[model samples]
Target: MASTSSGGTVELSGFFADLVRCETRLYNALNDRLRERHGIVTSQFEALRYLRDHPGSRVADLAAEFAIGIGATSKTIDRLEKQGWAARQPNPADRRSSLLALTDNGTQLVGAAEKTFTAEVAELIGGTLDSSSATAAAQALSKLRSVLERNQIGTPTG
Candidate 1:
């Protein structure tokens, strides 16, 4: 247990702490591997993968989906553009927002990286947790995410 500044004690086994620690560890491993093999970090790979799946999505759309700021999303897009992995086109519906798309190079890179990503996840997660445990954890996390999203927690207007 840890004492909070507010004179309360927090359980060390809290789900939030565990979730964050797990996420950090997983993210760092994925980031390192992706950067080593794909020449892009995990964030870039994720953005590219999303763009591949949701072609012509706007920066704001990406920002909302990733729960990040528009400025940060734009910077990521800018980096992708610089690397010739992504491009922006004028949006037909919204003049102020540009549609984002992955380039052919990005498409190929992400496809390859997806394989690596899957393998790493399987090796890291599958190696530790059994199938049933993994499924349960995923389901629980999904439920939590739904609840948070539904409540507008951490949302821009929350």
Candidate 2:
């Protein structure tokens, strides 16, 4: 492999590319399973889980946490509302924006989804690596994620 000017590691750029591909595949597989079991995509499942844990958060807050646009987050909240899983209540702190909340049904769905999601992820990853390797992978990925989050990393712009 040809080396880059930044470093002798020719695979540095490819490392990020491969990571993106891996993430895409993982999310696709997880989303498919989630949709099949609960009629909810991974994004919706994430939003629901967040709201379940952090009640009174707005769509904007969720969008920021999920690294998505406010408009998209609002749409997600709309779908959750339609499914009777989430509801928007008038915010006491801010009369302009309503806070999102998980209904009883939504809470139950998230609880069920969490069990299946965690199991599926473990099985999917562990099917490839042994217990120790899986743990190592988790630790490494968490570190990488922390750095990226701290740096506010996103899509490349030139």
Top candidate on TM-score is 1
Candidate achieving the largest lDDT: 1
Q: Write the per-residue lDDT of candidate 1 for residues 1-158, one digit (tens) a residue.
A: 55464637767568578889999999999999998888888999899999999988999888888888888999999999999999999999989889999899989999999999999999999999999999988997899889988887887641
TM-scores for the candidates: 0.90, 0.85
Candidate 1 — which residues are off by over 4 angstroms? Answer: 1-13
RMSD per candidate (Å) reads 4.9, 3.7
Give per-residue CA lDDT, model 2, range 50-83, as digits (tens): 9988888998788768777778788899999999
Segments of candidate 2 deviating more than 4 angstroms:
1-10, 155-158
Model 1 TM-score is 0.90
- Deviation in Å, model 2, residue 40 alpha carbon: 1.2
Q: Over the full model, what C-alpha lDDT does candidate 2 score relative to the true structure?
A: 0.86
Please report, as a residue range, the 10-residue window in candidate 2 with the lowest summed lDDT.
1-10
Clash pairs, model 1 backbone: none
